[model samples]
Every structure is written in C-alpha cells, then in structure tokens.
Target: MEKILVVSSNKTASETLLDFLRGSFKCTPKIVESAYQAKVHLNSDVLTELVMINSPLMDESGVEFAEYVTENTTANCILLIKAETAEKISERAEKAGVIIVGKPFSKAILYQIVRTVDIAVSRSVELYLRNARLEEKINEIQTIDKAKFMLMEYKSMTESEAHAYIEQYAMNKRKKKSIAALAIIDKLSEQYL
Candidate 1:
C-alpha cells in the first residue's frame, strides 16, 4: 500500500481528511500539524507516496512545504487553499509540479484527484525502477570490459583470448562471468599493476 502524509494545522480539517483517506483508500495516513513535523517525517527512511497539505499551516503557508516535497522527494504533493487564493498560488506551485486544489471541495472531487495522483505515482515508480536496473546492467558491462582490457594489455592476449579466458574461468569456478571478470581484474592488478 502507498504511504500518505497529511500536513494541516486545523484539527478538524486534518481529522476529516484522515477519515476520508482511510475510508476511501483503505490506507492510514500520517498526520502532522506543522510543516516542520512533516519535514522531519519526510527525512525518515520511509517512502511516502503522497503528501496532502492544507494551506496556511501554523509555521508557514503550505506552499513552501509542498514545493519542498515535490522538488526533493519522489512523492507527489497536493496543496489545498481557499478558492480566492488558489488561483494565485497555483501559478507558482504548478511550475514546481505541485497539484493545487481549491478549498470547499466535495469528497467526490478530492477522491478523483487522489486517485489520479495515485496512478501517476505508480507509473513514476515503475519507470524509476526500470531505469535503475538498466543502469546496473550497463555498469556491470563496463566492469567486464575493463577486466578484458586489462587482460589484453598486461597478459599480452588478444581481445578474443581475454573473452575466452574469462568465460572458461567462470565455467571452471562455477561463478558468474562478471564475478570471474572481477577476480581476474583483481589478480592481474595485484600481479602487474
């Protein structure tokens, strides 16, 4: 389940939001009365999927905190402000990728917006994981290549010979090709370099 963090100074509003989120989404959201508390929670290792801020927090207007969450974390943020001020705030908040919703909104509207943000966060996480895996694979390939180059230079072997040697070593040792390459690199570095 996705984790949610709610930042609101008003006790009544926070309770309402908490109930609505729990009932509608079947998830419990962590609530904080100030932006400072929210920041402390955010700094923890736990990953929050969504951050909902009721504007005019006791410590600061929620806009700065909303912007902080969007800029510094992977979490999606939604800022709720009075209808009169939402338009002005949206102009700046939207640029930071913060979703702005005017106050006096119905549960139905909030539900729809939350659902949409949930979908977007899910997709973003999938893409990020995919990219991380690709990067790991690329790094492994580069490491193997470096090992092969070392073999060619220090052992006076051709590229094909280095490749064959690493493959044969992995087969004989019952190890992965990358592990064998690393071993070869370490051995050669110790002996020659």
Candidate 2:
C-alpha cells in the first residue's frame, strides 16, 4: 500500500487529519509531531508517496520541512499554513514545487490536493526510471567502444573485426555485448598491467 506522512504538533488535529486520510485515501497514514520525527519516517525503507505538514511543527516551521522534503525526496508535499503566512511564502512554495494550502481547509480541498500530488509523484517516479535506463545504455555504449579500441590496438584487428569478435564472444557466452566487452577489457588489462 502507498504511505503518507503527516506532520502536526497538535494531537487532536493530527488525529482528525489521520482519520480523514484513512477514510478517504487509499494509503497508510503515519503521523509525526515534529520535523525531526518526519525526517525519521522519510529515511525509513518504506517509500512515502505524499507528505502533509501542518504549519509550526514542534521543532521547526512547516515551510522549512516542506523545502527539505521537496529537495531531498521524490515525494510530493502539501503544507497547511495560516492564510496570512501562505500569502507570504507563496513564491517560495512555487519555486520548491510544494503545494501550499491556506488554513481553514475543507476536507474536499485537502482531498483534491492529495490527489494532484499523488499523480505528480507517480509521473516523477516514471521519469526517474526512464532516465536511469538511458544512463545505463549510455554507459554500456561507452564501455563497448573502449573495449573495441583495446582489441584494435592490442590485437591488431580492424574496427569491423573487433566488433564482430565481441559480438561472437557475447553470443557464445550468452552474455550482453557490454558484459563481453568488459570481460575482454579486464583480460587485456590483466595481461598488460
């Protein structure tokens, strides 16, 4: 199940919010009374999809916590603040990509914000995975290129010959071309070095 962390110093208010989240959202709600506790929850192995903070946590301001959450984690955050304070920090919240909900929020407002943030978190995760795959592909290509050069210079094989050699080795070993290339590079390095 998806997890959500709620930071609020007020016991009664936190309980109310927790109950509402449990009833309305399809997620596990974890409550923390201070920013420090929130950090502990965030650092745990479980991935949190959404974080909601009520302004003025026991040890730190909610805005600061929101900033930290946004910069350090992929989770999306919504900070509840007094209307006056919300106006003051609107720009900072926008820059940090945190959603700010002014105080005196109805349950409907909170639900909508959570829904929006959940969608954003999902998209961010997808993008992160896509980029990671692309990076791995780029690294594989570079390693293969370096191994090809090693074969050309050390084995006196032409470019096409070196390419074919690696491909054949990979097919015979049932390994990826990059893995075969890395093995060749390691063997050459061991012999020469």
Candidate 3:
C-alpha cells in the first residue's frame, strides 16, 4: 500500500522505472509528464511515501523538483539520473536528505537499495527506542537493589531468604517483578501516554 511518485516526460522512461520498482516495492506511482505536474501531485498526494524523479523532464529539472519535494513533502525523495550525472545528483540528494538511484536501472539493484534503506531507517529508530528503555532499566535496577538490600539489612534475613521471599511474593501475586519494576520506572519517567 506504499505510494510512490515518478516524474518523467518519456513514456519509455516511466514504464522502465515502474517495471524495475514494482517488482520489488509495493508501490503505486503518480506518474506525470513534467515536473510541474509532479508539483501538483506532491501537493495533493498526502499519502505518498516516496518519490523517484527522472532527469530530463519536459517541464522541469529533476534536481529542481527534488529540492521542491524536500521542501514540501515528508516522503523519501530519490533521484533517477544518468551515470554521468550520478555524482552530481547524489550530492544534491544528500544535501536535501534524499538518496539517488543511478540510471540504467535494474530490478535487483532497486530491490536491494530500497530494502537496505528501509532496514537502516527501521534499525536506527529501534536503537533510539531501546536506548531510552535502557536508561529506565538502569534506574529500576537501582531501586530494586535498594529494596533487596533493605530486607537483608533491617530484617536480619539471609540474602537467599530475602530473595526467596520476594520471588514468592511476585509468584503469589501472579506478577513479574520486572513488570513491577518497569511500572515504577514508568511512573518516574515523563511519558506522553
């Protein structure tokens, strides 16, 4: 259900680009004859998730369109350019926070590139979340350790006995201590929900 955009004046180029991308991505492209028409699509297609602009468009330059897209859309914008312009296009895309897929395109290459980008984005987001959780876990460990130490120090209970009591309390209540610990952490943390 992912939406894609293709701005190409040449029917052959549009078809070829679609042929390569469709084989790999679950993509529905808004094809247009010129970059100007692409601008219209960009404004209206709120659901679009990606853009592929082929250079040499009838109405506008691919680089120019890519700039506009970066300014206007949250979608991942990529360029389709000839080998000679590959470096140039990529430099611009990089500055615009987009990526470029070089022309003489192949289905395999497109598939690999798209898959890699998806994985990288997902992994980065995951790591950010995991790191935030790790901070919470560290605080939880400090609290639980204090609790365990209190039983040994104040009640004069052996370390093993204190551990057993906590385990039994946790089991009898049908609740994991880790879950309780996380609840404590959540209460302390300023979460939105």
Candidate 4:
C-alpha cells in the first residue's frame, strides 16, 4: 500500500478526507496542520507516495503549498478544497497542476479517484517494465549481430556458414534464435569480468 500524506489545517476536514481515503485508497496518511509541517514531511525520507493539503491553512493556502510541492517534490500532490460556486478552488487546482478532490467528498467520487490513480500507476509501471525488456532484447540482438558481422568480415565466412557454426556450437544449439542472441550477450559480459 502506498503512503499518502495529508497536510491540512482543518481537523474535521482532514478527518473526513482520511475516512474517505483510508478504506478506498488503502493508503497510510500523515496529516499535518501547516505548510511547514508539510515541508518537513516532504523533506524527510519517508515513503509517502502522495501528499494532500487542505484548502485553507494559517501558514499558506493549499494552492501555494500544492504549487510548491509540485515544483519541489517528487511525490504527487493534490489540493482538497470544498466545492464552491465561485470556481476559486478549481482555478487554484488547475494553476497548481495538482489534483483536486471536491469538498464534501462523496464515497463514489473517492473510490473513482483512487481507482483512476491506481490505473494510471499500473499503466506507468507496465510501460516502464516493457521498455526495460525491449532494451534487453535489443542489446542481445546487437551482440548477436556484432558476432555475425565479425564472423563475416574477420573470418571471411559466408552468412550461411556463420549461422550453421552458431547453430552447431551455440549454448541452445540453435533451438531458438532468442537463445542464441542471449548467448552472444552472455559471452560479451564475460569480457568485462
């Protein structure tokens, strides 16, 4: 479970937000009353995955804190402000680039937000892992390609002859091209040893 820090001055408001998030977001929240505490929470090497702030605090407004957090911290930031007809809360959320959860948050909306964030995080992790695998595969292919070219250029072997030699002598015995490709990379890694 990710740790989501809630930095808010309004005790009742913070409790309300926490009640909504704890069950749905399944996040361990650290609530603070001022931006200074929020800063301290951020600066400390705690494993907070997200940081939230209330709309109004004596030290600073939520928007200011959100902006500061977005600019300074790696953790995702959000401003939780009561929904008003004036559009002030929305304007601040947009300008800060931090997410906003409507005031008097409903259970449905809370779950929806948590689920949306979950999907986004899942997709990001998937893409990162996929890219890593692709890089490894490319490196393996390059190593095999280099070996093939070396055989052709340095040993004056035909393409078919080189392929046949590797087929006969490779660790996988040419059962799979991927096996041979990876073997080439393994052989190259030995040189750095």
Top candidate, metric lDDT: 1
Model 4 per-residue lDDT at 30: 78
C-alpha lDDT values of all predictions: 0.91, 0.89, 0.72, 0.71
Instruction: Name the lDDT value of residue 105 in candidate 3.
Output: 78
Could you tell me every candidate's TM-score relative to the true structure? 0.92, 0.87, 0.58, 0.67
> How many backbone clashes can be found in candidate 3?
0
For model 3, how does the per-residue alpha-carbon lDDT over 60-157 read when each residue is reduced to its tens digit? Answer: 66788888888788667777778778776676678887778777877778777777766765676689799999998887667666556666666677
As a TM-score, model 4 comes out at 0.67
Q: Could you give candidate 2's per-residue lDDT for residues 108-141 as a string of tens digits?
A: 9888878777777778889999999999999999
Lowest summed lDDT over 10 consecutive residues: which window, candidate 3?
184-193
TM-score ranking, best first: 1, 2, 4, 3
lDDT of 4 by residue, 92-143 (tens): 5666667887677777876776677667766766898999999988976676
Q: Which ten residues in a row are the worst by lDDT in model 4? A: 184-193
87-170: candidate 1 lDDT, tens digit per residue: 887779879999989988999999999999988878888999999999988887887899899999999899999999999999
Q: Of the candidates shown, which would achieve the greatest TM-score relative to the real structure?
A: 1
- Whole-structure CA lDDT of model 3: 0.72
- TM-score result, candidate 1: 0.92
**Better candidate number, 2 or 3, judged by TM-score:** 2
After TM-score superposition, the amount by which residue 120's alpha carbon in candidate 1 deviates from its true location, in angstroms, is 1.4
In model 4, the runs with Cα more than 4 Å from the true position are: 36-48, 71-74, 84-86, 89-92, 160-193
TM-score of 2: 0.87
